[model samples]
Target: MKNVYLDNNATTMIAPEVIEAMLPFFKDLWGNPSSMHYFGGQTGKHISTAREKVAALIGAEPSEIVFTSCGTESNNMAIRGSVEATGSQTKVITSRVEHPAVLGPCQQLKNKGHALTEIGVNSSGQLNMADLRQELTGEPTMVSLMWANNETGVISPIDEIAALVKEFGGIMHTDAVQAVGKLRIDVKKTPVDLLSLSGHKLHAPKGIGALYVRKGTRLNPFLIGGHQEGGRRGGTENVPYIIGLGVACDLAAKNMDKEIKNVAKLRDKLENKLLATCPNTSVNGDRANRLPNTTNISFQFIEGEAILYHLSDIGIAASSGSACTSGALEPSHVIRAMGVPFTAAHGSIRFSLSRYNTTEEINYVIEKMPAIVKKLRAISPFV
Candidate 1:
């Protein structure tokens, strides 16, 4: 059977160029970046170069980037560290539709007596700016919001939100893991004090990510140990994966136009065809303001897991929700937060694409999905 992987949001296939860039580190330059020896120093220099490449991808200064294990680590570090730096009394503000990584840390803070306010989202998954403005009123706040929704690909008004946070004398952090490679991000213009990104989201290998800390941002270290990541994050660097992340970032920067144009074209074709062919189907989230490579659709009276299983059987991979939240036997928090009805919520499926996707692959999915939805809906009691 032909393999059509539509689950780029969960994790992407590693880019061939990234693999080529990383091989040298594992084979020949296998030295600790923190070591004082010549071999180690050489490896350390490449790490610095990697830092520059990562920074450049988001229009940040190289000194501001700190490497981490993944997006989850970056989010935890940004949220917890900012709260620590501010004090125990810091008010944490976030959206209801955020990834678990952001919500998990905020929940922990709430349990510890810190004030935590979860801003609500509209039916379209747009943030309620008025609610956020009201919550920004009391105490010194640290607002952690995602740049885009992972499930629905709904882009948040980050620039406006960041400006509001700053106006209220609050620190602003964004989980840009999904938005970084898919959308054009320039930290120089966005005014976000902190931003997180995972390398695997952009075709780099897993186990690599970065947090962008603005020059004056007061963030305490999340992991404490011997000086590494400029004493911001502890432990020895994973040099090979770091090198791969850097190369991936560089390629993403170069190919962003193609992602917006070609990948988006393929995604639109797939979405449009499925909608045209199927009955009782509707697209989720805002149609206009979203990532170019993602679409979430809900097929009424059918379960998303069933759709995924059938699609998988056909070698066409998709997702019911965030990979981090998979297997929970419930609708996605993101979908539920947006008030997607129980009928459609259980049936929501996310099809996230990538630059590597082709028109032919999109056509294949388009051809197969209507029948899958129909077959499953035929058995549903709700039907």
Candidate 2:
């Protein structure tokens, strides 16, 4: 049996080029970037170069980029930091479908006496701009939204939302972890005050991510110790992973155009075939505006975990929207937020592709998925 991994949104395989770029930092250039000695100074220069590379990937100035541990840290820094820095403004606005990273901080702030407004999405999983407009009527301290949803692959109208947030004078932040490599993101073009990205989503290692703080954005330090990351984030930098992230960003920039076409083609082929062959299947989210490499499909009347188990047995790796723990099934919050019927929500599966994925792999998945769905449906009482 061939191994097929289609869960790129959960995490991606590290690029070989990224590994190669990171090796020297671990063995030879092991000096701390914060040190003033010649050995450390050389390592510091490498860090600067990596900073430039990461900045270029998002069309941001090098000075605006602050390296952090991962997307979670970046998000916490943006939300927690901005709220603390802005003294009087207590209102924070966000969407119902944002990742835990963004939502967690917002909820935490709410517990600490800040006003929280969660804007809902339509049945199509598009943000309700009317609710957003209503929320923005009052002065909000911050607005944190995801650029693209992880489970649904629905791309938010961030440019428009950011403009609105700007007009309201609220500090805007976007969790761009899923959007950074798959989509073209130019902070210069978008007026978001802060954006967070995880390197692991783009074929870099898991321990690295960055936050872009637009010049003059008021933000308190999230992790304060050393003067690293220009006093925005403080700690000894993970040198090897930082180098790996830089290379990953460079590779992403070079291959982005090709990935936009090839990945989309393969994803569409897989999604179209599965929907056509499998009975009682529906595509989730706003299909017209989504990340090219993702498709979430719901096979009604069956448990998603059962389908995942069967796929695992066949050496085909996939993910379910339903969170199954201790034999209890909790449907995806994202799908539920989109108003997917209870029957379909329990059966939704997300298949996210990457640049490394091939047509053969996609075809193999398409051929096997229908039979798997059918087998599960036969035993499903809801059907």
Candidate 3:
């Protein structure tokens, strides 16, 4: 059976260049970066170079980048650190469509008596900035939102949100895990105070991520007891994975244009053909503004997980918006946030692509998708 991978939003396969870049660090350069000995001092140099690579990817100073275990940790640090350092009961603003990394922290803060209000989005899963402005109340707070939604790939108005947050004297943060490789991000030029990214989202090995903290931002340590990362994040780093992430960043910068054009075209080809062939299928979110390699569709009168199973049998990878997969009782919070009909929400399917995906593979998915949905619908009681 031929296998296809269309779940890059979940996690991406590591690049060969990233793997090769980390191989030496695991063996010859195994010295701890914290030691003052010559061997260890040299290890710090490698770490610094990796920091520069990560920083360059997002247009931040090398000193502002702090390595972490994953995107979740980076997010937790950003939200919790800001709240802790400020020590104010000020409001924490976020959208209803945020990932668990951001929402989970916000929920915890809310439970602890902090005011956390979520701004609602429209039918297209975009934040209503006017609602956000009204909610601000001119109080000192931090607002966190993702740059692009993972399920729908809808790009948020971060620059606009940043400008709005700036008006209130509150800091702003963006979870850029899905947007980092697919879009250009310049922290300085964009005016976002903090941003989070995951290595696995951009061809780097898992277990390494970074948080971009602007200079003089009010941030407290998420983990204490180590002097590493200039005390921003504690404990010795995952040295090899850090190196891998740096290499991935460099590769992304080099190949961004080719990636955007090629992958976006492939995604569009598959998406349009799928809709044309499937009678009741409709796309979700704004067509004009989305990540280069993602498409969300709903097949009416069908269940998403069953459709996913049918596609899986034919070696097509996809995902459903069911609560079972999302750690919630309802359908995907994103689809729900968009106010999608419950009937349509149950049939939502996400197909996320990557630069490595080929036109032939996309065509293969399109060829198999209609029949798979049809087969699932036939057996589906809802249909």
Residue-level lDDT tens digits of model 1 in 1-383: 98999999999999999999999998999998777899888998899999999999999999999999999999999999999999988999998999999999999999999989899999999999999988988478999999998999999999999998998899999999999988899999999999999999999999999999999899999889769988999899999999999999999999898768988888889889888899888999999999998999988888888889899999999998522337676678888899988788888889999988888889889888888888987898878
Q: For residues 1-383, what per-residue lDDT tens digits would candidate 2 score against the true structure?
A: 88898999999999999999999998999998878799887888888889999999999999999999999999999999999998645699998999989999999999888999899999889999999988886465699999999998999999999999899888999999999999999999999999999999999999999999999999999988878888888899899999999899999999999999999999999999998999889999999999998999999988888899999898888788876722556788899899999889888899999998999898888889888888887887767
Instruction: Encode model 3's per-residue lDDT on 1-383: one tens digit a residue.
Output: 87789999999999999999999998899988888899877878888899999999899999999999999999999999998888867679888999999999999999988899898888887888789889876787889988999999999988888987888888898999999988988998788888999999999988999999999998999999998889888899889999999999999988999999999999999999999999888888878889989999988888777777777888878788966565567889889889889888888999999988998898899888888777777887876
**Looking at model 2, which ten-residue stretch has the lowest summed lDDT?**
322-331
Query: What clash count goes with each model?
Result: 0, 0, 0
Instruction: Point out the higher-scoring one by lDDT: 1 or 3.
Output: 1
Cα displacement (angstroms), candidate 1, residue 335, comes to: 0.7
lDDT of each: 0.92, 0.91, 0.89
Badly placed stretches (over 4 Å) of model 1 are: 322-325
Off by over 4 Å in 3: 324-328
